[model samples]
Target: MNMSTMNSACPGPFVRRHNPCGHRTGQWAQILATTTAQDQEHFLVIYHDSDTELLPAEAPEQHYEFGPAPAYWTE
Candidate 1:
């Protein structure tokens, strides 16, 4: 797959790093499937760690929540 074109929908070229606990960090993982739950779409994601065997079960290193996309600003 093209790495440049990948976005939130695609898992990524993970980096090797260490967490606070000195354990090996996991690859950057994105949602592989989309489903409906809790009155909203469910696409669970996480950063893979050696401790977590499953990608879907891993915990994200960071969680980013943003407001609606902003349009081009004009004065």
Candidate 2:
């Protein structure tokens, strides 16, 4: 899925693998932002620990699993 085209105004839940930050590499996070760069999509996300990170929407080492945000994740 091309996340750069996704609606950033309404963030959703996503699971990432092999996170470069080396924390919670395979966990669900809330996507706070999505942007395009060099024809590639990136995602800025916040984890359960409140830690935020910017990751590629797709990469050789990282995998993204996107889904709807949980009920508890509300404004």
**Shift in Å, residue 53, candidate 1:** 14
Off by more than 4 A, model 1: 1-28, 50-75
Candidate 1, residues 1-75: lDDT per residue as tens digits? 222232443332233222443233323333434444555443343333223222221232332221222232110
lDDT values, one for every candidate: 0.31, 0.61
Q: Against the true structure, candidate 2 has what lDDT?
A: 0.61
Displacement of residue 58 (Cα, Å) in model 1 is: 21
The number of the candidate with the highest lDDT is 2
For residue 46, give model 2's deviation from the true position in Å.
Answer: 0.2
TM-score of predicted structure 2: 0.56
Instruction: Give candidate 2's error at residue 15 in angstroms.
Output: 3.0
